[model samples]
Target: MLCCFALSLVACATVPHTGRKQLNFVSDKQLNSIGAKAYSEILKREPVSENKTLNETVKRVADRIGKVADETDKPGFEWDVRLIDQDIPNAFCLPGGKIIVYKGILPYAKTEAGLAAIIGHEVAHAVARHGAERLSQQMALQGVGAVGSEIFKSTDGKLDEKTRAIIGALGFGATIGVILPYSRTHEFEADRIGQTYMASAGYEPEEAVKLWSRMSAIKKPPIPPWLSTHPADQDRVNKLIESSPDAQKKYQEVRDKIGLGVQLDVLMDQSDRQ
Candidate 1:
């Protein structure tokens, strides 16, 4: 057991740019295979957008940001992007770089730069292997709990009610104290890394802050950050503001800055439907 722990410590991975250490026992091949299967199933169920404008916009933004991510992380991901005709403001990049952008998010995106920020953030999650890191965390926690159960097993070979209750309480505490906070950390890390990606991709990093501002305006009532898997909207915006100067420096270094690119027109889609 000690040797296994020692090997795990030696095998820890470091996140590029952020330099954060990650404990991911899950192999990239395994995670990416699962992600590919899931992405295929999701695409089969979701109505992929046939709108040429939307498809072009999503694909373009994803391509630019994906290139930057590839250069930065060398994750060897096979990047693909699709625009889904959904009414929810959602976007996600699964492992191996499969990105899905929902139509409802176009209103929030506002411009090409805004879309870049969103795609950059999701791609950051993928390149950083946040999904695998999270799964590793869960596996480790469950293993610890299982070990504890065996160690504390009663003479009758079962945990007493009190011991079971104690284990459950510890599980809840770990969820609240470790898992929730780690999820929020992943989000904040993605936000920071995403700014670098957009800036390096020739999109203004400030658009990320603006994108969050627009989304927050419509956000529902807040929950305390400690109890939630995501940071409060205001807190996220503040951190972005704090991180913008460095991102700006990266943007300035790009020889062919695209600035904000083209403005998005969700109204046109609405009109077509009418």
Candidate 2:
């Protein structure tokens, strides 16, 4: 009881999505391993992009976006960006520099700023370690704190799906927790933080709003997986625009310091070439 009480107050976390202090009971290592394993399994099941043009576009865009983080004081993030030649328009960043962009997002991204919006958002999720934080919260919510510790211990450095499922079972009370609840709060957090990341990456924060506008337009037939998990697009876009005044100003000020309209132009130029 005393340990649980201490854990509750001592775990002061600054949410990457909102810059707010939140109670995070999950360990960073556990989060990374889970992301890594999930990413690996997904890759094995689906063919990753072998397209040269796609690869070049994603890398160029990723480089530009990653730089914005340094300008905004987000340091020490080892970044690796790759493009996957899938039909789905989606992207995600795993803890410790793993990132993937699908070709489907290209049509919607249209420009470097748009790509920045997507990558920045994914990176925010990783930097904030939201996945792990959610698992920690899940354990607390269930009053099974020991499961949280087990998750941390078993799913670090290197992990497989079986290990992931085991950890998920303990903390989440079901292997399907990750698939079922899908952590809606975490998605919201990533959106807020992703907006900041894009701004820092030298993209207009409003472009995130625009990107979501495109997302809102996604076709109804197949109903892509990203849409299913991502919150209501219009509402998210509105929040971004409402928050844009401050974020856009910061981006403008940064660009002016370097003498340009969004240093992201270079990446756009690179992507256009590809």
Among these predictions, the greatest TM-score belongs to 1
Q: TM-score per candidate, in order?
A: 0.77, 0.73
Global lDDT scores for all candidate models: 0.71, 0.61
In the range 1-274, model 1's lDDT, one tens digit per residue, is 3333654685478888888888777677766765575467567767998888778878989999999988888989999999889765666777788887788777778888898998898788888887767655655656633223232323343545434433232211121122233366788898999999999998989999998776656555543222233334788899999999999998988836565567776544553775
Shift of residue 86 alpha carbon in model 2, Å: 1.4
Candidate 2, overall lDDT? 0.61
Stretches off by above 4 angstroms in model 1 are: 1-7, 144-182, 221-232, 255-259, 266-274
* Model 2 deviation from native, Cα RMSD in Å: 5.9
- What is the Cα-based TM-score of model 2? 0.73
RMSD for each model, in Å, please? Answer: 8.7, 5.9
> What local lDDT score does residue 155 receive in model 2, on the 0 to 100 scale?
31
**Model 1 compared with the native: what TM-score?**
0.77
In Å, residue 260's CA in model 2 sits off its true spot by 8.6
Best by lDDT: 1
